[model samples]
Target chain A: MPSAEEAADAVDVTALLERGRTLATPVLKKAVDRLAPPMNTVAAYHFGWIDAAGNPADGDGGKAVRPALAVLSAQAAGAAPEVGVPGAVAVELVHNFSLLHDDLMDGDEQRRHRDTVWKVHGPAQAILVGDALFALGNEVLLEIASVDAGRATRRLTTATRALIDGQAQDISYEHRERVSVEECLEMEGNKTGALLACASSIGAVLGGADDVTADALEKYGYHLGLAFQAVDDLLGIWGDPESTGKQTWSDLRQRKKSLPVVAALAAGGPASERLGELLAADAKNNDFDNFSEAEFAARAALIEEAGGRQWTADEARRQHKIALEALDTVQMPATVRAQFAALADFVVVRKR
Target chain B: MPSAEEAADAVDVTALLERGRTLATPVLKKAVDRLAPPMNTVAAYHFGWIDAAGNPADGDGGKAVRPALAVLSAQAAGAAPEVGVPGAVAVELVHNFSLLHDDLMDGDEQRRHRDTVWKVHGPAQAILVGDALFALGNEVLLEIASVDAGRATRRLTTATRALIDGQAQDISYEHRERVSVEECLEMEGNKTGALLACASSIGAVLGGADDVTADALEKYGYHLGLAFQAVDDLLGIWGDPESTGKQTWSDLRQRKKSLPVVAALAAGGPASERLGELLAADAKNNDFDNFSEAEFAARAALIEEAGGRQWTADEARRQHKIALEALDTVQMPATVRAQFAALADFVVVRKR
Candidate 1:
């Protein structure tokens, strides 16, 4: 295993994430196989290996970060790496389940450089994809338990319900305006937070981490998720379009109710006024559309001056500190501990 | 519990169906809690208790026949009635999940005496309903297993995967025109048969019935589902609209290639000719509005005369015979055994 210094140098978790993706693809493919026609095509499209008409395509599947975290957590907790394979599959499947639905809700037409499932196959097929994904996750979890019948069943169930509960809160936030910063934190804590927690905590449950350690890892995951989101929110607008493969200031264009925007909204001064103007311009496609490079630069400046950027960075740093503290709870060797702690900075400090 | 002779008096299963519905309402309401907003509202409307506005409304939900059968299978498996509540909830949730997506596939506007979830909530929210439902079913299954920690864990994953496989086939069926009889049977086996088998099998796994008995119950469910489909095929064209609450000869109007129709197509006889004519008629109705009552009646007569009705009935009877064989595989009190045997007959004989 890489030490903390090595992990920091590795800056790329690509190989680990790739291994995780490889582990999950077959289990998910089996699920899609049991469901797709001619025993193949649709599953392939979901994995971005084929188009809707069943033609093969070499497409980027995803970073598959969750599955990697799950596998690593299991390995860290003393499970054989193979034991983590099913857990890795379970985490990836659940993550995709949410994405299938999230794309539909947010009206995202593309994901990972391909048409979203709903866009490609229409809503009906998309719904089925999400259904199959969620079912597959549970099936994988049970498969793990089948291998170790003495495992704590309650923990898996509780983790799943927590993930679902977090999804509920995330959806609820869409309807709610004027949410407090604390409430937003709480919402994200459950939605994105619980699942990450589960990725680690399920490892604990399987590897028999004491409740204290499991609870600490759950908090580790939660704080890490918040830090991750804080950085993501900053990148959503200022991110390099080429690097992110998305429109710059994309979240602003969509009027997304993210942390930076919420913080700006609550700050409620020139920042709020400028944010509202940008949103209205977006809604009307007036000055927002067909902008000159200078106009776009000016708009970006207004956004930053509004304190949205600073608030987000501050929050990310704060959460990273919390996440590092939680990492200390794990009984891994000093070298592995350093590697895990570096992950906290990697998440919050990412430029893209 | 009702006796065989007593239930044989052409009694209404309405009360039994209602009991399942009543039990599910609170369970679903709590499961689709505040976190899932439009999803909760969408699921609520699908259950027929809420309007498009999320306000309460008076209307019928589904007949709850699936869940009723689940409970009955558990009882027939000789478990305490209460143990089946989670199974009932799981089955109903899965059924509704299928319906939510099916409505999207068929562009069905109304369901359960109300607008379909997609009709009012858009396909996105409907997708969430289906996703949440599958998740909820797994959640319920895990909870059920928690109570029985050691038992049912191994097979629960298997049973749930079977359902996923079934639904996947059903999804892929929409695009394919060349489903073989055996393939179609396998699909139906997964769709209708698997869940029914799970109902009783889970019961046995939970607390009652030995391995041989569970196998018997599962086989009984398999044939019963085939018989039920046969009856549905019969009703598709010949059913009384008042009783079935479906348009008269609607399946013919839609040119549905049902089991009997598929059988006829394979045979290439008079039934095939009639089926072709019906398909032509459906092709002519660009808006599903060109069918005159007289022409509909003529087509219905053709379907009846060309052995469609008789063939369906024969298939139903043959399947019932198979189901009877399965029932005989288990030992029960003569009176109790007669109960399940009669219910098997009821699958084909009941109207609506």
Candidate 2:
């Protein structure tokens, strides 16, 4: 018999995501349209609906995975996917809001293979646009004008606080000399897991699911977010630049203390020691100005040799298994459970 | 007989602000405490509750004007002052959130005679902390978990969007050659008026007032905000630097197209024409690199000669009158109405 993973892989995730986008995009567009002139223009460009010069364009706008989670979550609670449209739009807006601010904070120039909002419109507009999107997200949720909507807004704002805390921790870690694997995981959980948890449960909560069910779905998403981050960490170090829309060893260039780096430094050996020394020296010099492509490649090789690569990959699988197990605990429809499992699998093993 | 303004001005505005601060500070501190580590530290410092080293200090945590409006609105609706605490905290948090981000975007180094958060910590922390405070504001309102809470949240978020829109317009205006007084008023209305309107009415909404009463209170606050901004504009240019905590002719040095500048340009005289030319030339060069305090003072003199100062002062009085008129349309306790008038008088004439 085929393994459970293989069975889960049979799910048509592309169709699921397409359904979510189909349902959520119009509402999302309406919210963005409410923004004033230049903000509306900037947000439109950021969403890939327009070119930098404001002409219409068909560009990548992510996979709409968060929205899919939300719609699926409402369905898991035996409600129509339409019941979750507001929640889906709210999560997507919050996700994009974070991206805009994070891009500016990280000094990143490009995203989705195009110039970032800050790069094109300058930092002020980026800040304002991110703020506008965030406010728009809250507006969308509260406009529901029900007790459940209040509960949902509370969840979103709480998750947002965690997300911001994670960003703060991430920035602080860049300047520190040593970071434990536990510390790294906590940061990742807050940064990535918290919002995903909110995305996974907010729709169900809005759909009038009991707290027990909502909490279970949130646990599923929390674990899935950890799995997703591990895969992203791996890609940051070793994935194909074409797939990631980034340069090779992109994380190394930014001197990020991602999971792989933290795990490797924790695994003590000659190779680990040497890897630590190299990173310390690079950090002390504070700039990769004198470094070359060969240097970054060498660092990546050292991390792999120190077992960082294999460890992170195993952690991803481990978290994916836990995520699926959380789904099994919830008494949802088999098809809904299967969809959640498929999303977990996709999160772990996807190239980008 | 004494004029209404003189009678209203006798209401001891300082005591009113003090009462607001006393009622609102603890809850505000509790909300700030919920923020994760470094964010909490940055926020405490920003609110003037602590020094850079985290020692407690009695800093000027604003005049608590927004909170007073919220509490008084609730009282006017026949609810206790305590019923308005959540709304007061939400508006105060939003105000500080905007200040943090705006200070960074404006590249302002000091606030209230202290280094700004961005200057003391870094740009990334400033952005993150501002975002955290905003999320916290939403959390405070929605945690009430009622339909009314949802309505209040929607109002706050809508106002927040308008606030962000106004900021966007302000930034865009900086790059343009000319801005009409009407355009400037629109921007100020969105930026300052919206939030104040929300503050003034949210408590009443939460206190179970009907829409008409809430709307009347909103109008009262909106006009008050316009009047308040006018006084702020006057202080920006010609107020004593010792009281303003800024250099003389501060707005002119930054080349701000505040109400005074816009109104003066609209006055259409030789001084207005000369002032416009000077500003246009300054914009063409795009930097005040070679400008001196004397030049800024000369610009201020030209604005005053063009009737900008007189027009703005008159405008403040007009808006204040309208704000009081809004209060007359609402049926409330006489004492409550008197307090509202007192606050309006204070806003129009306050030095700082």
Pick the DockQ winner: 2
Give the TM-scores of the predictions, in the order they appear: 0.88, 0.96
Report per-candidate DockQ: 0.41, 0.82
lDDT of 2 by residue, B1-352 (tens): 5455666666778888887788889999999998888889999999999999889999877768899989888998999988888999999999889999999999999999899999998889899999999998898998888777788888899889889989989988988878999999899999999999998998888898888998899999999999999999999999999888887888887778899999999999899999999998888775576787788889899999999999999999999999999998898887778888999988887898
lDDT of 1 by residue, B253-332 (tens): 65565665556545566766766656555665576567688877776666666666677789889988887788777766
Fnat of all models, as shown = 0.43, 0.90
- Model 2 CA deviation exceeding 4 Å by range: A1-7, B1-10, B285-287
Best by lDDT: 2
- TM-score (chain A only) of candidate 1: 0.84
Q: Residue A82 deviation, candidate 1, in Å?
A: 1.8
TM-score of chain B alone in model 1: 0.83
